[model samples]
Target: MTQPYEVFVQWKRGGAHEHAVTVTASDREMALTLAKRNVDVRGAPVSIWVTPRSEIAQTSADDPTLAPSIEREYRNVSWYARERQ
Candidate 1:
């Protein structure tokens, strides 16, 4: 039976792998093959990743533990651009 696989590609070295597309295949090898054919058709990515969709982990959107560790009011661009008192 075919299963869904997630495809990721890194366009350049030291870059992050970005989600490319999903492919359905019978096994890992076929998934990789299809990912290459579809994702690497251009200049070729620095790397390609094919992972079974079921194996990837996801976090709850509202998880409190995942919140930022500290307030960062100064990091906002408006904070610097606002009218100075």
Candidate 2:
């Protein structure tokens, strides 16, 4: 069967792989199974994402296409914010 889609995984709480990437699978069920297999191989995972390639929309490859001029201040947490006040 043709590869149906891509899978994104959240391996653990507070862990970072940054963001999405491509993976191939026959269907969502198979993709989830593959994700579990990958987690078994890695020995950890908190969540998984199985999205069809046809279902995804993304920017095309080009200079400044992925440029990050704007800061995502919300993505950061200061030490003070992490502590109980």
Candidate 3:
């Protein structure tokens, strides 16, 4: 049976992989091939990933449980970094 897969493409080395497109295929191999051809047809992507959609988990944007519950400034290190000359 075919399943829906999420495609992610990295356009440059050391860059984050962002969602590119979705494809339906019977297997992982086919999904990758389809994504490669259609997602970035004009140029080459540094890397590509095809994952079954059902395997992903995400929380709703409106969920309040992820909000910072308390002040945690002590844990932050941005101020400790040396300023560039």
Candidate 4:
């Protein structure tokens, strides 16, 4: 049976990997080929990663634990404005 795979591409060396596309394949080799053909037509990517979708873990934005319990006022733009005054 074919499985869904998430494709990630790195545009250049030392660059962050970005989600390029998703492909369904029986194995990693096929997924890589499909991902390269479908997403890297211009050959711009320096690296590619194919991970099974089922293996990925995701968290919801609505989750209360997603943010820190303590205040982080220094990270806010208002904090900078207040400091300038």
Best by TM-score: 4
Off by over 4 Å in 4: 75-85
* Location of the lowest summed lDDT over 10 successive residues in candidate 1: 76-85
Relative to the true structure, how large is the alpha-carbon lDDT of every model? 0.88, 0.66, 0.88, 0.92
lDDT string, candidate 1, 1-85, tens digits: 9999999999999999999999999998999889988876666888888899999999998987876779976777878877454
Per-candidate TM-score against the hidden true structure: 0.69, 0.54, 0.74, 0.77
Q: What is the lDDT of residue 63 in candidate 1?
A: 85
lDDT of 4: 0.92
For candidate 2, the per-residue lDDT at 60 reads 73
- Candidate 2: where are CA atoms >4 Å away? 14-23, 63-85
Tens digits of lDDT, candidate 2, 38-76: 555655667777778788787877858465679865555
Global fold similarity of model 3 (TM-score): 0.74
Candidate ordering by lDDT (highest first): 4, 1, 3, 2
lDDT of 1: 0.88
Q: Is candidate 1 or candidate 4 better by TM-score?
A: 4
Indicate the TM-score of model 1.
Answer: 0.69
lDDT of 3 by residue, 4-79 (tens): 9999999999999999899999999999999988877757899999999999999999898877679765556754
Clashes per candidate (backbone, < 3 Å) = 0, 0, 0, 0
RMSD in Å for model 3: 2.9
